[model samples]
Target: MTLGTSTSPLHYYDVSSVDGFNLQVSMVPVGGGVGCGVTGCETDLNICSPSTFE
Candidate 1:
């Protein structure tokens, strides 16, 4: 059997986003000689303050 053809760009995977119960990792260039690994972005933020009461 033969597979179908892909009309999208070679780097199409890096230019797309996913949504749902599944998890995926994506990389995108930021600037000169630099790139970033972005995933589970919700956990990468400071949504709460440090412990104050013990």
Candidate 2:
């Protein structure tokens, strides 16, 4: 689903169940946006993000 708004397009991610016990999530920018550290902008998550931006 679209993580952010259509106008902003901050992030896009997919979600699914893993082993019927846990959740699996993967995210990337809608177009071409900066990641975790980008001067005035930054990204945060309760768990973790991939090593690479993807």
What is the TM-score of each predicted model, taking all chains together? 0.18, 0.22
Error of 2 at 49 (Å): 22
Q: Give lDDT tens digits, candidate 1, residues 1-54.
A: 122358632331222223321233444444423333343333322234244311
Instruction: Give the candidate number with the greatest lDDT.
Output: 2
Give the per-residue lDDT digits (tens) of candidate 2, residues 1-54. Answer: 555676895654444333321233344434564464222113343236455432
- The residue pairs found clashing in candidate 1 are none
